[model samples]
Structure formats: structure tokens, C-alpha cells
Target chain A: MNDTNYTPSVAYLGPEASFTHIAAAELFGHKGLTPRPTIPDCIEAVTEGHVAYAVVPLENALEGSVPLTIDYLFHGGELFITAEISTPIGQHLMVNKAQKDFTDQLESIQSHPHALAQCHKFLQYRYRKIPLIQTTSTAAAAKYISEQPALHIAAIGNQLAAETYGLHIVEENIHDFHFNHTRFVVLSLRKEILDHKNHAASKKTTLMVKLPEDDKAGMLHQILSVFSWRRLNLSKIESRPLKTGLGHYFFIIDVNESEDHPMMKGAMEELAALGCTARSFGSYYVYETDPSSE
Target chain B: MNDTNYTPSVAYLGPEASFTHIAAAELFGHKGLTPRPTIPDCIEAVTEGHVAYAVVPLENALEGSVPLTIDYLFHGGELFITAEISTPIGQHLMVNKAQKDFTDQLESIQSHPHALAQCHKFLQYRYRKIPLIQTTSTAAAAKYISEQPALHIAAIGNQLAAETYGLHIVEENIHDFHFNHTRFVVLSLRKEILDHKNHAASKKTTLMVKLPEDDKAGMLHQILSVFSWRRLNLSKIESRPLKTGLGHYFFIIDVNESEDHPMMKGAMEELAALGCTARSFGSYYVYETDPSSE
Candidate 1:
């Protein structure tokens, strides 16, 4: 929801140097905002009115869907997607200032496994058969390596993490894909951020729908048919099994338009008749691509 | 293709304690399998002609997509999906045998961040706000905590990891859902096994297509239109952006018909004319529901 009077301070799922922090930073970059730790904490902050808003990662270009983000949106109706931000995630081969040029051209390649996987080609082409140590975070890897200078290790991390941990950017953008971007959703109590920004007018809206436990396949068909019947476009749909094991499934949907339309209203109504939990992430916006570069 | 005469050795992503290992074990439960140490190794094993099939994760019940599996499928057409297996995943709270009981319950709760998030509810319900330590693997956490017994530290992992490391199950099924499954696909060099199991007449086939470096939306439409054009049932469609960067996307499609049909042949021809790479994974008998469980 748009709060014209206040600059929204959003909470993100984090531990100081998480990608969620990066997402929050990008979401609030134009507005100059700060982020709190943890997605649930972010949801709680929004619910308790500690901050004007919160931002969390709904999906990643490489990893696909994020379930906790979907689950929180499905369960917590207090916050809605005010805007969306997509940032190109070009990870790096960062090292502590102490580690110099490689003698073997390869030491230990330390990083979060996901980061390691994203830079799979680089590691394979360069190291081939060297040890790949998994760290909790890129920051954690950098942090640990900063203390163990003699260990001869290079950590794959973000630019910010390298700078923060006094590490040098030994190699830039080691990820397999140069155009990696993680998409984030800005959440707020107000459901109408679209009108204020004029920025989100052309943006997409994300909806989370919880499917009924009984006859799962049939229920999925009925819900999908609603979108089909209306000729409404769905950009993405991710099915996440509800963790409570109640046999219910949650579908995180990204549509090309807002929830204000008659067709969308009808779709939601039909969705409700199916006897399931359906909630909107309100008005969301995604980034325009830099065609020549990206 | 299936090789009915020869039992092939297989490579999968895992250490003995990994969920990947559990999936590999279950998928090859009836038949013996040799598990590889890593997914890259698995891919390499198949590429080097050491193994006929490699089992890799396509998607998780909680997470939407697994990109590397798709990347390998796209990069190497020499492999095809032979068997699809779904393995149940449930997080467990384990403690060293020496530390029989948690003193303060949780001076700390250790796990991979994913496991921590998956059992967020159980953690919040069980303990007060305590430090949650993230490790590379749940098994790593179990091994660490088991080797260094602490009163209030409990590790979250699988039963196998806990038992192997001489840890007791402090809490069972700590995952968010009961039906949590990671889908695994077996890639083979030839379609021999399926052909052996198939009758003289059979109906479905799996195909992998690498769309041109152009309009992604248009490609998805054309891919979908082919099945809709033939009135063929399109069951599953998954897309992975190719590693080569912008506009290049790889799609995996499952159709309820054989390639022998002229309509299907024409559709394949049309798809090929669009300047895309397509390869068939052959046709095989499949049960939507697990036959043994059913």
C-alpha cells in the first residue's frame, strides 16, 4: 500500500548480508529505506505497524520459487505487495585482502552452495577437481576467510559483502549467467500503492491461493480454468505444498494486471467458491530490461 | 532409452547423509545403485560413459525449480528422462547420544537455513527466541553437534544422518508438510528400458526443446500451441533459461501421445522449423500415483 506521507522502512529475511537484504536495498533504493532482519519478523513488523512496509524475495532467477515468502503471504493478510524490484545478481570471486594471485591458479573455492552452483561453469572450467567448501553465506565465507588469511581460499560473494568484510573483488561476476536477477516484492498494509506511484500502473500483481485438501488435481484444474475463462494472463504460477500437511497446496501466482478488473474479480470469486484460501499481494511492479546490456 | 539386458551403474548428487542420497536410495530401492559425491560428478560420470543414467532433482515440493538439472538436460541431449521418482523429505531434530536431553531446550538450534525455515513453526512453538545456527548440511550439523555434545544444542537432519552419526531423534518430522517430495529424473543415453516395458502400442512421450534466442513469450506459446493444435493432452511443461544468457530458454514438455503420429510428427517438424533443438525421451508407462503406495 502506498503511504505518501511516510517513507516505508521494510523488514527483510536476513542476517546482515543476505540476498534478501540486497533485495530490500534495491526495492527501497529510490526511496532511501532501511531493512530489518528475517521475513517473519518483517511480516510481524508490518502487522504490528513497526515499519511502513517490508520486502522479501518471492523467487530467484536460478533457484526458482521461495516457499516461505509464498507461505507468509498466504497466511498473513495484513500486508500486500506494494511494488516489485528485480536486481541482477552478479556474484563475485571475493577474497580477503591478504590472499594474493593464485599460485596453482586455484585454492579452495568457498561459498554458499547455491552461489557455487550459479558459478558452476567458472568453477568447473578453472578448478576442475579442487575442493569446493560450502559456507553459510557469501558474507560468512568472506568473514571466515578474512580471519584465515593463510588458508589460501577465495569466496564467491556479493560486492557489498566483500567490501564489508574487507575483501577484494578478485573476479567480477563469476556466475554462469551474466544477467542474473532476483525478484522481490515490497509489502505494506495499504493495498493501493499503484495509484500513488503511477510507477506501478503498468506492473503485475501477485496472488497466493491455497488449494483445498480434497481432490487436489481437480481443484488445480478448476482454479486454472478460472484464469482461462477470463483470458487473463498469468506470468508465472508456482505450486508449493502447504507445510502443515493438511493436504492443502499453495499456488503463488503472478498476473500481468492488478486486482481491480471485473475479470479478475470474477476469477477470485470463482476461486473462493472452490473453498480455498486466496489472497492478493496487492499492486506489484517489475523492472524494465536494459535490452542492449541485459 | 531403456537397456533391459544390462543393469547400469548410476551417479546422483549426494554424500551418504544428503536428502539427495535418500532420494537416490528410494529411487534405486528395488535395484542397487552407486551414488556419486556431487551433482557435477554425476553429470561428469554420465558424460564420461561411466554411468548410463544420472539421477538429479528437477523440482522440490517447497522450492519451485531446480535450474542445473534443466541446464544439463539442455546442454547434453545425449541424456533423456528414463524414470521419474518422488522422494518424501521430512526434517528431523537430532541430538548426540551423549546429550540425551536438551537442557534449556534451545540455547541454540542448528540446521541448514532451509531446514530452519521449513520447521519455523515447530521451532517458535518449542523454544524461545534463541540463536539458530545455519550449517552447510543438516548432516554436517548433526556430525558437528554429535562430536561436540552440548546441553542445549539440537541438530536438524534426516534419521539416517542422525543414526549414522550416533544421534538420537529429538523430534520427528519437523518439516512443514508431510507430503514434501523432491522430484528426481533418471537420465539415460538410450530409450531401451522403456521400449522393453512398452506394449506394441503406447501413448506418451517426453521431449526436451531448446528455444531460439528470441521472443520467450512467443516460444512458450508455440510450444504450447503444438499440443493444443493436435488436441494432445499436455501434462507437464517446465522452462529453464539456458546458461548462454538472454533469450535462450530450454523447455521440457510431456505429451500424451507418441511421436509416430503424423500430427505429432508435424508438430515436431513445426517446432524444428522455428529453429529450436528437440529430442525425445521416449515413451513409458507411468502412474500419477505411486503404485506401491496405491
Candidate 2:
């Protein structure tokens, strides 16, 4: 399984045509892609040596962080984020081909809760009276709607889902915000590996830092001070519950520098000297989805 | 209603016996407590003058922040936090009275997905084969189980929910963790007010701060630098999607100081000078739940 010469397969959270499937295809091409039912399953597939890597949603622009992915990285096995992929999310109103002409008379709308919530404005303005059912995923909704062509049900999902399920796109880009995007991370047992065709556009080193138990005043500021003076640029800063109790949190800082950089190393060393436990989640290369290829 | 002198009824997010209901009852008396179907409904009840205030959960120790409450505060109508309530979360396994003696032979378990996820370990160990149903809330599950007397369905909810629905608790504190807590905020048109019997145990000022559009390097550090120099202790710092695009976020910072304090005021001014837009969400006094009273 550790054949560095030959990269095997990759697993993603999916039932085919889900966002993770799209991301996995974009990263590893259409070959040897396995769709796991859940995020945990995808991650376990990698750790259990079923696949060379796993791709899962890390965060969304409108919905914020994916807790399962973050929690897995924080508390689960020894997996590292080997690569980062950012893709623009385009949600469409898809219906079965049998009822394509009767788009206005939808019996019900279905999608993942987040997707339904994303298209909330459109749905409220148009299909306000129609019931919105929550499914396990966008693809699941699309599959259900496709399976029951007699039922006039619409699904809010990506274009791939409509194509995969033989559905027609009734409306395009129904999402409330045009700026919706989801960030996916490639998790691998080994670090600093990109088995895909795309080259690295940039680099980011994510560090999970926990301050000393006695949260003294300005402790977080001091932690920031370590990187502030060194001129390390931070792309994102997020705090997650330590799960111990209220008022306890650990910061996930994404620094715009490679882990091997002197400044990054010095900052981690300084954090330790200040009695903070800092772990480098990963130093991964950032890649953007090729719109032309899609 | 402009009747600041005369306190009116309050609205809370509830299907009866929910955590918000418990928090509302803890803050206000049992009288004049209206239960709204949703968080937005509760907030709207206050804004539309149906109620004087709305009590909604802001954050949970395990699940993190409640986006609906935060979004309403940031983007919705004019509202201010008048009071804050912190309550311990105790999840219990409850069954209908008819099946009280057959707890071990339960057919299914139902709860809000968050509640179900919280009690994942207990459910897996005891009744792994039981089908888990997702309800809108834990109280909803309790209500449903109570209504269906013939079904051997159990609900994992609070003690109040079990008592309210006349259900028997088969297991107490079934949640995997013991340090779970939820912070609920009392939203009102007027600020610095507490309409309850309990006095303020502590004070906190929450600020919603956004960095300039250019997002210069170390801009966040500069923002923190203002409070760092003043030695303002921050209880929590969370970043939410600005809903514009990726790599953009506005932070919700909870500082352990009154908004009127000079240090706090100076920090806002400094932030303003640093090309940051900062708004004081509220300067509310925090009240701890009286466990003995419950």
C-alpha cells in the first residue's frame, strides 16, 4: 500500500455526483475514485489503507467550517492535509426530465439542509408553499427525484448531479449568494504529496495552537505577537471548542508560508516557549479548480 | 412598544420544554413566556412589538456557535443584547410512560441531530441496532414519543422535557461529555437591562469587527494589538463567513469588560483608526443558572 512509485485510488464523501466527488475528480482525475457514504468513512478508508488519499470538504464560504472534517483532523488518526482545493459552488434547480416542462408545479423540493438553506431566497420567492425535504446529500436528493420521475420534485444540486441522474436543469445558479465556494482538503497519511495533475499555485501552513490551561489576559495576543513581528501573513483564523467546557478553545491559524520557512519554525518554537501547544496540521499546496477543464 | 417601564411578555425558540424554554423560564418567570417556532420568529416577535424581548441560544460548548442567532444579530433588524444566561446542558434518555418498563427493548431513538450526535457513544454501546430518527428538536422528539403511546420510541432530551411530556428517564446524562453548556442571549430593543430577578454575576462586551477590504498582512494582529496593550481579556473569538467570498471573515470577539470602560472604548477607537469597522454588539451582564432552583 505504501508504493510511492504508483499512486492508487482516492476516496471522497459521496454517493456519486456530490461536491466531494467533483472535487476528487478534479484533483485525481476520473480514474480510481471511490465514493464513501460519509466524511468519517472517507477518512477511515485512507487510514485503513483502502486508498492512497481521501478528499473531504474542509469549509464553505457561506456555511463556514465543516466540523466533521476539522474534528477528524484534530482528534482522529494521523492524517495530514496534503493538498487544498478551492472551487466555486454553483447550485442549480434540477428536476426530472418527465416533468421538465412543469417546473412551476413542483410537489416538493429536496436537497441537503445546507443546500436548501442556500437557495432559501429563491425557494421562498417561487415555491414558498411547496414543502422542502431534507436529504442526506444533494446527490441523494437528485437520485431520489430521478428514481421517481412521476413525482414532480426538484433538487438543488450541482450540474454533475443533474447529468449523472439524467435530470434537466430547470434553473441555474439558484443559490442566494454568488460568492458561494467550498474548500476541500486532500488528506493523506504521508505529507507534502500531490499525486494529481495540477501544479501547486501557492502554499499554506496550518497550525493548531492551544494556549496554556490558565488563559491569562492577552495570551492569544502574545501568540499572535509571535507571528506579527515576524511578518507572517495569516489567511484564516478560526477557533473551535476544546470540548472540555465553555471559554476553552483552540485556534486554527492558516499562515501564508511553508512549514519549512524559518519564520514559521521560529514562531512555533516561540509558542512552545510561551507554554502553548502548537501542532502543524499541514503545509499543503493550494490549487484552484480549472474552470476550462470543468 | 416604547414601554420600557412596563416589561411585557418574552419570546423564546421552542416547541415546548426546549433548552431555550428552560433558559427563558430561568430568566423570566413561568408567566408570559411565549414559545416561538424558530429563532427568527422569536427575534421577530420582539422586533414586531409582540414581545419585549427574545431569548435565543447563542453558542453551545460542544456544537459551537448558533449561526441563526449570530446572523440575525449581524444582518437582521435593530436589536441589542440586554442579558446573557449560561446553563448546563444535561441530556437524558427518556421513553413514553407506556414503555417505561421495557426501556431495554426500545424500538427507536429520536432527537435533534446535534443531540443524537452528542449521545452517539451511549446509543452505539446500548442500542446499536435501534433506528435513530432526526427531529427538529429534542423537545419535538419527546412530544412525538409522548403522543405515540403504542410506539416504543425514546427521546434523548433534558429533564424538563421528560417531565413535561410525562416520560420516564431510563438514563441520565447520556451525553458523551459532562462539560456541555449553552449560552443564551436575551435580545431586546433597549440595552444594559436585565428584566429578571437574578443580578449580574459578570459583565461582557461583544464586538463584531471587520478588517478593511484590502486585508493587509497583520491587520488582525493590529486589531488584537489594541486590546492586547490595554490588557482586555477575551473570553471567546470566533470568525464567521462574511458571505462575500473566501478568505474574508468578520470576527465576533467576547471581551471581559463593560463597553463603557475607557480601555474598551479606547480599543474600539484604535480599531477604527486602523481602518477596521467595529461595532459593539452588546455590553450585557452574564447570569449563571441557579441549579438549586431547578
Candidate 3:
């Protein structure tokens, strides 16, 4: 009876109807899609062979890096980033269908703090005195509001959340900033899991470089110089705690080049020789998903 | 009636006993201390001439940069960092004095999300099934627990929070990492606010640099090269979003040099000519506070 081979199993950070779910559904078409409660759980599903791949939010255009995802990728068991899904995040002010007309009676506005913060201006102008409640996730907040009908509570989440939880969207694009997008990465146990469509807009190679412990001064500068002199254009560079101690950090550099490129390889080798532990996270395609399609 | 002119006025992010308050008291003592609800409020207190100085957290060892403080420094207003205070962060598990002996009855565990996350291991091992709640701050949680006695609620915060709120420390140093430190900055409208103690370990000059929008490639490397070739030691380098759009960033670099130093001045001039808009945040001394004294 355990013979579901036609569809590839995929996991995403979710409680269902989360942005991650939207991203996973956009990529995998909702077949064999499982929702894990946390980023680690999503990664674990892939590592344990429970799912062929996992999709987790790596960064938000507004919030910057998702530290949990970065930390897990750095310390957790081996997993490769196969693809990046960039989805335009549209935060919606939603309420239970029964209480949609009674929004003025809203005593509380509930959402993940990030979502609440993203739509802070709108909330401040519209419901100034409403108490804000923080939930584990936007989807979780939506689910809670749906379960407790006519409670005069509103949740700020995505369109998918409103649809999934049977809530009515009172306002769309309620985020303070319009250029909001969340980058979700597809993680796999194998090095490369190419998309069948392969209609990627761009390619990037991400590297984790830990500087030499003793060589204190200009070590980071030297590492960057190697990449610079080689003419490798860096799209992003972030430093996460090494977790060993304070002031110890490992740089995550996203180079706009493929992993197999000569300049990228040269930079990695030069960085290694400089007593820096440089490792390739992966060379992956970035797919900008059109929110309209979903 | 208001003739108390002996103490200098200072503001901090607080309900009275938050970590920012501790840092403020450690630097300025208790006299003329004002507690502001948020980071922006604390900064506004300084900028609006409500206080001589405002103490705010800038970065944490485990968590990295405090985005609010960074953002305010970049865009909020013109405030100079007068001094840097490095405090040892000790997260203690506390609860109402009435429920000190009945930790097993705890139905909920609460703290700021960062504090809660820091004590994740301890919470998992001991209060595995306890529902975790997020408050605005650890001190706020402690304050809430104090007001609602015997509610089977526990809070994770510093020692000061426990004492201030009349709670008992059930577990001390519950944070998983031992070497945790939070760097707090003293912000003032004036360029300098020297401590009477005249004891500082080192001096650092922080510069905010924004690359020319069009000159994309190798711009960051060139900026680093300016400091690297000059042999100026860098303690910290962080990139905050310009907020203009995605992928646009402005860097904050801390150099181990005085602002007046010849080489440092030369580097700043070179950066200016390189088509980068560079501004001096401040050149200030760093103070390592003794937790034992507190």
C-alpha cells in the first residue's frame, strides 16, 4: 500500500496556509506536501529521508536573514540549498467571516510579531488602541482567529491563510512597505535537485567563510579582497555568530556566480589557504514566483 | 520644589528593570533616571532634549545586532554614541515569590522571544510541556508575574528584574551559552560624554558608509581595502538595509582607532573620495561593567 511514487514528497515550515506552504505549493503543486511546525523540523524531514526536499524561508526583504534558518544551516546536519523561491509577501488584514463587519469591535490584533510590525503603520492609523497579541506564526494566528469565531479579533497574514482558514480579507497589501518579498530556499540531502522547469532568473553561489582565529586584524578584509580581485560580484554578505564565543563569526557570502565558475573556485581555494574554513553552501537557481499566479 | 540639580538625567528602554535600565544605572547611577517604553522613545528622549543621554542595547553576542538601535542610528536622528558598555548577560529563571516552591505547577513560561529562545534548552529539558508566552521584554514578564501572584507563570530575565519585581530566582544562569554579552551604547546629542570614572579599556571609531548606488561591484571591497591597507583593526562590521529597496545596504564599521588619529582621518577622506557617503557615528571608549558590582 506504501507506493506513492508518482509525486515527490516535500516539506515546508508551516502549520498549513503559511507563506512557506504557498512557496512549496507554487514549486511542487501541493502534491505530497507536508507542513512542519518549525524550520528545524522542515530540515530534519529532508535529512531523515521523510521528504525529498524541504522549503523554508531564508530571508525577508524587510526583516533580513532568518537567523534560525542560518543557524540550522551552519550547525545542523548536512543539507544543500537546491533552489530559492522569491515570493512577494502580501500581508492581509483578515477577520473571521462572522465578525468581518464588526471590525470596529476588535479588541485585539493577533499575528506573528513580524507580521504585526510589517503592518504597524496601518494598525496604528486604523485600530490605535487595539491590543496586539503575538502568536508562533501568522498561520497559527489565522487558525486561532478562525477557531474562535465572532471574537472581535483580527489576524494579519497572507491571502493563502485567509483562504485556508475561511477568514474574510478586510484589507490587502497592508504591510508598511510595498517592496516586501520573502526568499524561501529548497533544501535537499543531495547536492543538487534541479527543477524540471529550470526557468531560473539568476544563479548564485553561497559560501560560509570562518576567518582564522589568531590572525585578528584585516583577516575579513583579506578574505573579501580575494573575492574582489577575482571580479566576483557579491549580492549579499552576512555574519552569523560562530556560537563558540562572542566576536567569533562566520561570514555567509552570496556570490552572483555558479559554484563551478573558475573565479568562484579560485576565491574559495585562496580563502582556504588564508587559514579560513570556506565551504560552498550550494550553487542554486533563484526563481521569483509571481504572487498573482497563486 | 524641583531644585534637584545634582544628578544628570538619563533615559533607557524600560519598565524600570530591563537590561537597558541596568546598563543605565551601571553607567549613570539611579539619580534622574527615566524609563522609556521603547528604543525609539529612549532615543527621542535624548534627541528631544528630555535627557542628557539615552542607554540602548546595540548588539548581543549570541543574537548579533539589535536592528532597532542600528536603524535609529542610521535614520532616526543625529545622536552620537558617547560610550560603549559591555555587560555580561545572565538570564535567570524567576517566578512570583508565592510560587517559588511550586515550579512544577507552571502552566506557562514567558519572556521576550530572544530571552525565551536563549533558554530553549533549559525549558525543553525541564518545562517541556509548559506553554511559552512572549512579552515585550523579560522585565515586563517579571512585572506581570509579580502583579498576578500564584498564577503558575515563570519569567526569564536578569537578576535585577527578579529583585525589582519582587520575584524569587528559581534558577540562575539558565541561558545555554555562558559567554553571552550585550553591547549597549550611550547616545547623546553632544559629541562626547566622558565618564567621571575615567576608566575605559579601549577606544573605537564607528563609521556609517553607503556605497554609490550605481557603482555596484567591488565597492565594498574597496572600502574595506582603505582600512585594511592602513592596518586599522576592525571590531565589528554590520550591514543594515537602506530601506530604499531590497539588496540596498549601508554598512556600519567599528575601527580600533580614534576619530582624530591621522590614519583614521586619511581613511575617512579616501572613503569620501571613493564616491561613498561616509558619516562618523562616534569615536568612544568601551567600558566593561562588572556584574559582581551590580
Candidate 4:
């Protein structure tokens, strides 16, 4: 029997112990979080009314953007971003407790491709000969290592994953860069929730703008001038393929203004007048999760 | 014993039959193409003088930019883009030849994440219940299916991979989109080759520009104006994190002009005056591989 009376359920990209899991726990606590296998499944759960919200990683400091997440939001389905959570990523080299001398006998390492790549320097310098296995997620890697109980095999994951899978940390802060962080966004099908949650002072509005198909000089510059002339800060800009053909792209820009801001609306109007179509994906406040809490 | 005098060696991302392998063969045939395990290895092989050139995917029409390749060229090592090759990606559903009628008992499908994602619609529609296994490369997936023949196992990869690994094509053109293509670039250490090979009329110059640390309104607009005022055509523009902190990024722009072009040099000089730094990654010719030849 399904119990929906207690708390609202949230779906996150997971097998439990993923970075998205930590992000979901950070925002909504650990009680009503459901671990979904893929990004689409997590998002679809919200759209299909199976969950109240879905938390998925949007971007990483090291890896520019999660392509699947960006693609899905830009073109796949109709879901609005309600809020964002930033988590400090700390990748650890973890192994089974029985494998005490992991460095001496470590035959192979496993992790998601991004995690493996973040810690590439350490692996190359210390264990060049060891093979690296790729998994769907870092949590999956930790789960696999815990279940297999193989000697000389380890995984690169976060502290939450290590604890969830009953693995010991072989090395801490294994990622190459110290400022590693990932930003996860909360998505929901209901527009009322997004509209009601825009009271926070610190907000950002995201827009997907497709320029005219014709090759016009200074067209992209003109689009940026709409925001710059208003003196509104532009935080991020990324180009995604329009998928119509080669060399065709639509730009996704994040402006430091809420949807309710008059300037933001005016800019969108001006962009439209210049033969560009803009789709606003709602505005949301960003909350940074404290590393000390973890 | 190695034969160095016979042919110049080239490294590609490989375990024998990767798309990069196809790109390498497209450029240099199959004889001197050495298969390296990872992108870094392939790039490093050229930088370390072990090979003459390294072929790696830069971007896919559907997948946007290849983060690892972009990051490495932007921040990792000293290498120049000498040439660019465009390859048409054709994903095929392959199975072991001996295992006929695999669809009836299809238990699992395997491929590189990108390949799998590109064919998500087909997989979800036809084999909804089958488990999808992630492999290092699509070529590796085909090879695995060939070596360890299973009744219900299939792989998604290119036609060359099916031929290389001796697998039978169960279905051709399995990808969801028909115009799927990947752009591969040749990375080399010598600047002379890049300069001498720029005679082709169709060339593109790439520049990495870092904005000022202090946030200023209209600064990005000013930078774009430099390119726009000169009537220069930008083929592509992407922002990559500088890894210093969140919201800090450096832009990589591809201009339709050679590095030696007078207007391009003027644009770079003006960008410098605006408290920004620009690094040129050289101009290279683009060659499209004819699908009919394959």
C-alpha cells in the first residue's frame, strides 16, 4: 500500500548515495526522497504526478554542463525549474573495509566517467597501471564494490556514498581541483509552485533564445546588448545545438533578475522584435549547501 | 621492435574500433593508426613525440561539445589544432553472427553513454524491458558482444566497428536522428604544420578569451563588438569554466578567418585593451569525409 499522507515525495537521479541524492537530502531532508535510475525517469516522475518534485544536477564546476540534463530541459519536456541547490563535491577513494592495504594491491578503480576524470591526476601519478571501470553513477560504483567485495578494487565517490555502501575512505579529497561543486535544480510540472517560490531576493531567470536562421553579422552581439543595456548582470551563457542541422544553435542565458522584473520582460520583448524566439523556464532562488554540515 | 621509417604513427581514442578509430582511418587509412585507451592518452602520445597526430572528437551535432577534449585543449597541455575532420556517425544494432534471432530473447543492450543517449527513443520503444549496459566505447561494446557471444546481447556502434569486431548488423541506422555527425580535430605539437596547412580556403580560427576578474556591465558586449564591428563571422562560441570558482568562465570563439588575418589580429589587440587576455589555438582546414567512400 502507498502512503502519500505523511510527506511529499521527491525523485532524484540515483541508486542511492549519488550527488543528486545528497542534494535532495540537503533541500528536503532524507525522508521522502525516491532514487530514480536515470535523469529522464526522475523528471518524468514529477511530470507524471508520481512525485512532488525532482532534483537533478544541472552543471558542475569541473564539467561545464550535464548534456542530458540541459538537452532535456531545453527540448525534451515541459517542466519548470523551481529552485537550485549547490553542493560542494568531495570525491573520495573508497574501498571495502576488508581491503586494508588498498594502495598496495589495488588492481582496478571504478566510478562515473566524470568522477574518474575529476581525479585523473591522482590516478595517473599513483596507480598508472590499474584499470578504471566506468559505471552509471558514483553511487552505483560504490554499491558494486561493496557487493562484490573484491580485493584491490576501489571506487571514487562522495562521503555519503561511502557511508551508504559500507565502504571505508582510502583517501580524502581525491578530486584534482579544490573548488569542485555541482548545482542541482528542483523541477516540477506545476507552474503555481514556481510562481509562489519567487519571493527570495536572490533569483535568476533562465531563457532559451533561438536566433534567426540567417547568418547575420553582429546578431549575437545585438542579443546580448538587450541585457547589457539594461545593466542586468548576465551570469551564464551556453550554446546548445538546435538539432535542425550542423552549425545551428540556440543560446541559453541566465540573467540575474527575476521574471517579475520589468527589465527582464522588456529584454525578452526586444529579443523577439529582433527575430529571436525566447522561452523563459521560470526564476528560482539558489541555496548553497554547507560543506561543514556534511 | 617498431618500424618508424615506414609510416608516421597516429594515436586515436580506441580499443580498436571507436568512432575516433574511424576518423583516424578516414584520414590516414588503417595501417599506421594506433589505438589508445583514452583521450588523454591519445593527446599525450602526440605531445610526448610518440605519435605524429592525435584524432579526437571535438563535438557532436546532437551532444554539443566534448568536455574532456575542450578542457584539455583549453587548460591541460601544449597542443595545437592542426586539422579538422567531419565524420558522419551511423549507429547500428549489432549482435554476434552465430546468435541469430537475438530480438526474441534480447536481454541486454550495451554502448557508450553518448551512443546510447542518441538512440534513446529507439531503445525505449523497441526494447523497453531490456537492461542497458554502459561500456567504455561503442567499439568496445561491439568487441565484447563478438568475443563473449550471448543469445540476447546486442551493441550499438558504427559499421566499421561491426566489421572490425566481426559482429553482424542486426539493424542499420538505429539512431533517432538522421543528421547525427561528429567533428574530430587533429592535435599536434608542431606549429609549422598548422601554419603550412592553412592554404585551404575553408578555414576556422579558434581563440580562448578570459574576461576581467571584476564584474562589469557590457564587458562581454564590448568583446563581441570587437568581432562584430570588423564584420567577422563567428562559427561557434562556447564558455568553459576557468575552474577558479563558480560563475568564472573563459570563452572559446571560432572565427571564420585565419590567425594571420589583419582584422583578427586587430580584434585580439582590442580585446587586450579591454583588460582581457586572448590565446590563439591556430587556424585549420575542415575536411568532410564522404559517406559514399566508406
Highest DockQ scorer:
4
Residues B39-107 of candidate 4: C-alpha lDDT, one tens digit per residue: 666777898899988888787522222666787677864888888878777888999987766566888
Q: State the weakest 10-residue window (summed lDDT) of model 2 chain B.
A: B60-69
DockQ of each: 0.22, 0.36, 0.32, 0.43
Tens digits of lDDT, candidate 2, A123-170: 768887998886656887899999998988899898789889999998
Sort by TM-score, best first.
4, 2, 3, 1
Candidate 1 displacement at residue B30 in angstroms: 10
Using DockQ as the measure, name the better of candidate 1 and candidate 3.
Answer: 3
**lDDT, candidate 3, at A51:** 95
Off by over 4 Å in 3: A1-25, A28-57, A60-65, A95-113, A120-155, A168-170, A194-199, B1-17, B30-56, B60-65, B98-113, B124-137, B140-154, B188-190, B194-199
Residue-wise C-alpha lDDT for candidate 2, range B50-78, written one tens digit per residue? 89889988875222226656765776638
Question: Which whole-number lDDT from 0 to 100 does residue B98 have in model 4?
Answer: 77
Model 2 has an lDDT value of 0.78
Task: Note the residue pairs that clash in candidate 3.
Answer: none
Q: Which candidate would rank higher by DockQ, 2 or 4? A: 4
- Whole-model Cα lDDT per candidate? 0.65, 0.78, 0.78, 0.78
Give the per-residue lDDT of model 3 (tens digit) for A153-203: 999989888988999999889876565567788999899946556446568
Whose DockQ is higher: candidate 3's or candidate 4's? 4
